[model samples]
Target: MTARALATTCAATACAATALSLLLTSCGIIPGLGGGDAPAEDPAPSAAPDAAAAHRELPLTRQGRMFIDGGGDVLLEITFRKLQHNGEYLMIEVDHDLLEPLRASGTSTDRTAPIRLLDPVTGEVLRAIKDPGTGLSLGTYFTEGSDVTPVHQGIPTTFRRYFPAPSHDAGHLTFTGSGLGHVPGLPVEYVDEFTPSPEPNIHDYFNEYAEKTADELPGELFYPEEVPEPGLDASAFRQGIESFVDTAESSTTRSGDRETISLHADRMFDVNADEPTAEAAETIRRTALTLRENPGPGEITVVGHTDGSGSDAHNRELSLRRAEAVRDLLAEELGEDFTLTAEGRGSEEPVAEEGGEDDEQARARNRRVEFVFTVPDTAAGAGGEGLDSAARHVAAPAVFFEDLEPVATAEHGDVELNVYPLVRDGAYLFQMVGFGNSTLSDLEADLGAGEEVAGGPDRVTEGTLGGFRLLEPDGPTRYVVRLVTEDGYEDFADEVLTLSPGDEYLALAVFPAPGPDVASMTLHAGAFGEIPDVPIR
Candidate 1:
């Protein structure tokens, strides 16, 4: 059935608190919703029908499910109410209810989990507003004079938060918060203000006054009045979202119009030497090509970093020499069109932490070279080709697949992986996989743990499915999971957990859609190895 038809069925069934489970169960039939037509041979005998329910995507008015670890089988029912535009801020309202009693009351804090809005057109993630003076988020807080009402089981509690208004005139914004992962296609409504006050509307009073700086506004607006400050516009609070595209040779991070291309130092240098290695030629050539496509203000900054294994002084000097060496090669590639400057940071700005079981792995990641430059806004992803253009997109509503059966399966030890066919949506393609443990004991699968030489920079989080990527069936282009950099680098994907014995979990990963001429691609499933011939529908 079509999404519209599903919506009609949901409306008829009344997506209420009592019918939330029914809505989630019916979602399975919507082509790419969740668990669909089962395969003839069961690869994961422990897998069940509801393994992918946690990653279910639903409309704003409909009730969706969220799986909270250690909450047992009690799924949270989230109903998005509004993405209303206020005077200077955007207000988001949602009603949440716990399916069963677990001796815990839902608090407003759960609704404030790094709320962000995705601009599908510009590939920007809009963040919540914050108080510049106090450096505190301008949303619901559990401090004094605030509502600390506890949300009981089965009780629908309404919560609202304020955010920096979108700078564009888009009709809709994709809303993602805490467990309500990427509720795409949320209609944006313009209103003077929300009436009757949303529950835990701690800072709604800011709406009464005109947009002003902390000092310009009345002292009573703050908890402890201090020196008055100049008022600032909403534009000043805008935080740019960073987009990442990874290749075997280098990784590129695009923030706004600026791009930071990171190449592993190991790939460019031998041991602790400063000279260029044989593999450095390919990476340097790729970087030069990207710079030519998205030329900036004629100046590029090259920075170097190193692991914490060496002494501070030696590491700093070595990193500097390496940076200068790489910068020289890049200058030669770009000729006199760009002026490249080199600097070294040593271990001061390490991307990954040290002193752990994965310390060596983290050190390998930290040892890299970065080329930072600003690209013309028009030049960024201009032709919409290659991996860079494909990285900056979100999944849309497209359903051409007949069955959600696993087209490929890979087994490693007791862990089994079942990958479904790809679902092409707009400029993005969505892929789902079922991870099952055949053992009777509990399984702790860390998909991101890879021992190979680092391919690119990674986010700061651990135990995520960030290692998953897609390879062109017969081409050189590789696509990594789209990173949502609102708070930090988080995968623009959703997941369901398998914490019990004889259980299977389902997860999702989104990537830039390949060209229309391409029909299938190879999936790189971290520990499960590579699954080939995954059809795109």
Candidate 2:
């Protein structure tokens, strides 16, 4: 995968002494005992008690409460107060209530910005818009001069942010950020026009600062009359996808309109030789079946790569020969209807770094063959019956393993991992993992250091479960954790939690949903080994 840094142009400032303390209403906070101009009068009762109750009952779709610190201290409660549809943009409102006191020194310039909305089924990630002139993300920073006001203990602060309105028809989208984890199934409320709240907003504060320091900052402060509204650029937007592993020998990845299947070259050929092994044909045949099941348009490009062990010239020549050999066999398996091409790029692209303590394992990952092509629109989440043999390559889901569970639990040292049943949310699957620290002192666990199953790849990140995967109980296909990426930012579906002694941290992982017909999966939890019979809801 190509890496791009997500550039952020906003920062937090020092905490201001003044903030509002408002009462809770159905859709928003009632403006009450805060410092502002005259508070707007509360709306009158409409004489419909049931309707008001229903409105108040609207739920915020999120997992367990998120904490500022992973040690279960410093609880930070978040609420999706509103999602109003404005012209060309969606106005998002969120409330942050920090239960514990945060010191003024604790305020970080890098902490306050950017929220994303992900439409799982459509694979669209929506980011907050930046003003073309200033490149500032269009959101509230609660700034006082140059620093942002920290959330004082027991006071709730509401933030208003804006993103380009989704072009799709999804009624709900997943809300995610560094503070709030993956919050799925949030309903969007539509409005015909945008109205500024009576709250003391960031613009008013920033505008005052701009005037006081006119020598340093010179520009039009706030433009309420001419709000920037950029048109939707659908053609330029890139779609993200989940990676699936059927076995140690191969893995499948879908991105936007294309799909790429990677096969382990070491398993297909002998050392320093381009000839296919006796067992290579079966793997190729299974791959052919997968292609036919999820048929697509355009020429399938077969690319070969080798490890950085041999001479560059020799390795390139050998990789080319291997690519040609695989292309010839694929042509025989797939009839004359499909066009195929071959190329070799020996050691040019390496997914894992080489000169490390686990150099050999990284080298093993570098040697592979890839088949790239465009997948048809109907192919995603399309179910298929894979071969019953151990080398199954199909994308079918597992429907068994629900009744046989007390769930599964495992331990590595003082840290214990308890993986709960899976929950399916549209195009994604959510897995909640309960972590417990049994010792008297805090324990540090390195998830990336877990031993691989049968020489498979290691975990990608250390504290989080980024390298872990979910496998089909009846087949070899492994559904990896969905990676949410933007510009230069990337994170797995899990969090980096600190395990305090006798305390528990319930984390989350979002994976690509298999077919709806599937019911059970096996989690390859790093350090904890294989946990089977994990039922999906």
Candidate 3:
């Protein structure tokens, strides 16, 4: 067709499809748009066979976004709403709440226009058509009379929305008339993603949400059957395990050369869907930054989990979906330095007890996404794995002068200083410098970059990089010595220490030592300049 002819036909098609699309826009059974087959679930309340019990079950993607009318009165709300797409079209399921005055009052509301799908990025208004005789819809206490007439409280108003499916690269969009709030960059799953829930379980599944029995509740209680172990025991150590940090929402534990960080699934996901909420994505992004700062040579494993809810198949699918979602986000942030694997453990091996129906809160704890980091065999195994590791950060420790030995001494005016190497093992090395004031006057070493080093004896600066150059090693390096305290580590340059008459002061320095061969290093003393080759022993 010529450009003009195609344009005319396209406009006509959109216009022709609008009316039917409005009827199918409410949700479920999009007529011709549903990839062809109509789902088993009932259609709109008017099109379905039942009116005595028009139940609109809540969907898996509800986000509880309020859609208020011109007044501040919330006319509609979306909870657990999610968006999906086939290669050809977009499928959106919204669990909604239509809070009308009362259906018995015969009150009605107005739907300003058929739902509008606006590509938030390009401002393009995509057209949609009625997918007749296709899709699934069910309702209870829901009357699909007009676009507005919501049933009273306790009855859910849910539906499936279909658009011409945006470009594959399209991310978020805003809805004006029917649905509201922004849509996420929903990754598409094939139209026949998986066979919908088995036939018999259909009603049982949708109806299940109406009655709160699923252990998949988040922030809700599902007490565990097995008592949580009071604390990790020594036996845990023999299993090649090291130390661990844990909290209600997340936990980081260590093994030989591996560290595993687990973030509760509820913290990262909602209901049975896989797309992460913005809050969850932010949390993941933070973790990625930490890893960048503390780069580790290890394999990454992302584990997705669900609580004891739904069938084995359903839980497995949901868990896998969530894990894959997290993996994608992590991959984007972490880059190619890390090899990541995404897997799912459907409620199989829960950290909680073999909880039954009563374990609602306990089950909440079970839903989580875990990241397992496995480092190079020997390097990671030498220590208690990540015992000393941060998300990728390190802080200095407190230094005490009492236990240190003077490896070198220098006197600057009224102050005498001595250096001591306290610990030198593995990647970390520490030293303590003690200061004593022998004169009546208080002493403040104007070390200021320790310029006195160049002025000190050649014997003092020979073979060394000069001053505290030893403090800053060259080439492939490890941790370096810096002033450290119980409060946290800081640069020696940042310290403002004073020594009074007859007073003794101890200052600590930390370093990322490269090897175990270092027997001595030059200690740059304030004003005193470089103390020649201070012995490590």
Candidate 4:
């Protein structure tokens, strides 16, 4: 019969054919069946069904029984969920019936028959199976009776169950195809030979298979498509969002930075009515909004200043009221988010000089409350990156003075004087010198003529000017030497000075003509330095 005809006949009655082939040949229906087909060219053994074609005939999902070449008279029956193309190895699920025929067909005296699964596309023999107990092996064949050999060494077989359930475990059988000189002569190619366990749910098994396939498949197969743009309006929408964030950041004032909004009140309200104006109220609202938007750990100083027109006491009170008004508004609007303090400088620092037509403007300027944000030194250190150069300047060493006094006394010519030793360490010292030119006679009479000051007052010492020694009773406390000049001469005082722990020094108090003929006096402190030139009248 022709190959196609034989294949058709086999397909029509594969089971019956298998049984008939076994029985007829063994019982001699065609004499000398194993030697060769004879008489009228007995169907040339159906050209050993092409393994490639056989594999194509195998179903992807094993819903029905499958027949695979099990070598000689044995055939393998397979039932599989899915067949996997694992590059080098093809994995499949086979039912127990797949092994039954091979196990039964082999006799105690015969050599093992080898069964095989082949890859027709690559012409590769992928895996082999053999049963040692039955002396039966299944794999790629080299010659016609290669499977009939007793020592089926190269064939490898593994058995496992694939279950669809809570636990998805599948059995794997792998055979190295590189050992095969050429492709196998198996009837079924790329056969899935392992059986799946029935205990697992079928749906789960399929789901697992799909998931695995997805993972193993090449990336190009199911990638998502590129999305199209949304048009020019989309750009505008995005820009709007950015603008929102920028505006929010700009409006928000940092906690310790200087506040931009300030408050001012006219002199008429120096005593009271520093109430909030509509504009000021609005400004406060804006400031509060800014502060609330950008919260931080800092304090705002509400400094109130005043023009020099009013008495110091009244001006201080007025400025404080103005500052308090602003503070109250901020507190009401901002709540507990900010730390605020109110202070008044009174007439101490005038924005403009006194005695001028611009007094109104000066008054307007001074009648104001300014807010300065102050970050604590510790906080500033922690947030150094946020601090600007000016903020850093504020923290630099400036000037601060505490105690000042007179140290010694002297008399000369018409000048009887009190000298004060100025002590200082900071950048510069400040002193207000007073000149009272009095006669020496008045000084001598006042002091009983050179009578020394005995055991001077506490923390103060009286010492002789020439000798530069403190009186025996005088100790190491800081002193201010006072000098009083006679009439017609100016009185003088020294800027603050610093005296070391132990140092001896002489300071001279000189008297000269007072007023017109009035002579100036040069006062000196020995080791600590001398006072600068002063005008005496």
- Candidates sorted on lDDT, descending: 2, 1, 3, 4
Better of 2 and 4 by lDDT: 2
- Please give, for residues 1-537, the per-residue lDDT of candidate 3 as tens digits: 000000011111111111112222221100011111222343232121222422222222212112122112223344434455555555554444434332221211222123444432222334333212221121111113212211224344344444455542444443322222122222233453422321222222323342442233222111101111223121211112132334444555443356667777777776787899887877787667545543464478889888877999998889888989898998998888888899988989676653544366567767888888755322312111221223322212111111234556777667676665534322334454555768776555444333322111112222111224343122221222222223432232112234445434444333333233445655545466766556543
Model 1: per-residue lDDT, tens digit, 198-297?
3323234433433433235442221211111224454544555455565545566665667777787877888889998978977687667667766454
Top candidate by TM-score: 2
The lowest-lDDT stretch of 10 consecutive residues in candidate 2 is: 23-32
Q: Report the C-alpha lDDT of model 4 over 1-537, residue by residue, as the tens digit.
A: 101000111211211122111110111000010111111221112121122221111221111111212312222222222344322233333222222233323232111111222222211112222222322222111122212211111121122211111011112211111111111111223333333323322212323333442234222211111111122111110000000000111111112223333344542234346776666666566556544433353577777877777799998987888888888888898677678999888889654455556555545655656666633321222112221111111111111111113333454433323444321111111122211225322121121112221221111122222212221111111112222112221111111111111211112221111112111223333332333333221
* Whole-structure CA lDDT of model 1: 0.53
The estimated TM-scores of all candidates read: 0.58, 0.69, 0.29, 0.22
Worst 10 residues of 1 by lDDT: 1-10
Candidate 2 clashes: the total is 14
| Candidate 3 residue-pair clash tally | 45
Off by over 4 Å in 2: 1-72, 84-88, 98-115, 130-136, 144-147, 150-156, 178-180, 189-228, 231-246, 266-282, 351-367, 376-416, 436-459, 477-489, 497-503, 515-518
**RMSD to the hidden true structure, all candidates:** 12.3, 10.5, 32.0, 46.9
| Number of the candidate with higher TM-score, 2 or 4 | 2
| Residue 448 of model 2, lDDT score | 51
